[model samples]
Target: MNNAWTDFLARQGTLPARTAEGATVAVPLTQLGLIRSRGEDSAPFLHNLLSNDINKLAADAAELNSFNTPKGRMLASLLIWREADGHLLALSADILPALLKKLSMYVLRSKVKLSDASAELALAGVAGPRTAELLAAAGLPVPAAPRRHAPAGEGRVIRLGDETFIVALPPDALPAAFEALAAAGAQPAGTDAWMLATIRAGLPLVTAATQEAFVAQMLNYELIGGVSFQKGCYPGQEIVARTQYLGKVKKRMFRVHIDAAEAPAPGADLYAPAFEEQSVGQLVNVAAAPQGGFEALAVLRTSSREAGKVHVGAPDGPALRFLDLPYALP
Candidate 1:
């Protein structure tokens, strides 16, 4: 969303070509949408709608949450954290406008102001073993560990997980900020580099085509700290509760590798011949793997997954080789 940084990346020819191992890489996270919520009742307003417990959010910690439809289908996945004014919610830009409009409808009498800050703010995705050291040198209060954040003047530094960190600051400060980081031995990359790291991190955000197509569990939200079973009622609480209480999650998202000529789109149908023409799953997130072929996260039927035979487009399309997810499943 930072036009200037986008121009910088274009003119600099830093479009991420490969996520080389152990290299410090930085990219403008233009694919994400930033929503700023400020008001006396901002917390309560969002607590009543999101899948996680907003009341328990801490000033220095981030929470992964989802905006679900009443029927328990996920519409958007959010990485929420506190800011000086209120809260900052980062999500996929493709679904932001529609999701923001739908969320505003419930504001009826709340003293909440939800503004799209994507255009006003700049996001930088930095990943590498030296991320913390480089960021601290850039005057950012580099977070101590994953899921933690620290304030830095008008900007904020968050360590998403492991070596991956995101910095949110005013658009005008992006060029200087990234210049400092890159000078500190960081490689400037494209958005694709960041997207690949996110996939390996086992995080999924609802895109337009996949909206309302999968529940929180199907995305492995519970296992990844995106849901709170003890939290009070929110939209789709009952259905989410029922799914949790049920015997087991029959469908789930998994990390897989497909050696195809081209990567498939999100929400594309997946098939297992055992199902015989019945779609067994849908692709959730996809990116071209740096190591050739494409790596993706897809929701698959437990039975199909157990059968160990799933393909894309059709039963005979590209065969997907199962891969390990960063986190363990229940």
Candidate 2:
């Protein structure tokens, strides 16, 4: 078995368990996460910095956005919400610290308070055909809109019909929820399994390596609804909007198959013959592919991407076979 598969099986039963080829991982997040937001400054503060329109987020709703630099490179990808007390921001576990630090620096005078909520929440990914049934069994109401979250604070809830959600539960309440779900036939999964679902979903995660590297659009943020062009200005909003409206994108994220024994680490360099020693792109994330070899997501320069032969390193590096993503590029 490949490392990805092995890792998946090993993490099975934990929140976000690893699963078989294309299987989804469901994790319990109660004690594993935390949730925090600004009471008054939550919405406005987030609106000013995020690539999406915060004002548009309805109560009991969720919005996808990116925290990008002035150059349009994304610092973090976020799932923001309008909770009872304030707004919530959900990001990959790895980028939370950096995100909090950056947001804090920007809050200089703003009334927003940022906290790592991963500790208090139960974050899980539910992939596979049975996700909806499992969620419904758990009492999580199905979301009417795809990629949306609804109000499920006090009781069990479901959303998007099939997609599992990350829930913030008091530490004491998690065991009971997990037990209930387990009794309902929901299996426990690990982080890697969740990662597979994320890849299948075509969701791009921000890691330390790819931080401040590509603009939100370069990663297909708009196609995934991570960018809101009509929203007011935020950091790098101009560049993101212009690129989309003018079709001036020079680089883009892609899914590829690697017939190698090694899994490429995030932020690894990618090269092409046309670029010689100069790098044409960087690896965003990688996992052992179920079909064979390795599969990964990468952001490549437009010119180099057109060449088709993308290498994981210098010219002598292993070859990468391009794979079709679940979504279309703009």
TM-score of candidate 2 to 2 decimals = 0.85
| TM-score on alpha carbons, each prediction | 0.96, 0.85
lDDT per residue (tens digit) for residues 1-330 in model 2: 123322433444334223466443455322122336766778888889889888778776676788888988898877776767677676666667767877888787777787765545444445566766666687665666565665555522324223546544444454555555666776666455555556656777787778899888778888877887777889998888788788688888888877887777888899998878888889887766666666778899877777788899667799988888888875
What are the per-residue Cα lDDT tens digits for candidate 1 across 1-330? Answer: 567766766777647656676677888887898988998888999998999988889889998999988899998999999876678899989989998898889889999899999977889999878888888777677788788998766878888998899988777777889999988888888777787777888888688889999989999999988999998888898899999997478899999998997878889899998897899999988887767888889999988998999999987899889999988987
- In model 2, which range of ten residues has the least summed lDDT? 1-10
**How much lDDT does candidate 2 score?**
0.68
> By TM-score, who's the top model here?
1
The pairs that clash in candidate 1 are: 16-190
Q: What is candidate 1's TM-score against the reference?
A: 0.96
**How much is 19 displaced in model 1, in angstroms?**
2.5
| Residue 65 C-alpha lDDT in model 2 | 82
Alpha carbon lDDT of residue 190, candidate 2?
A: 49
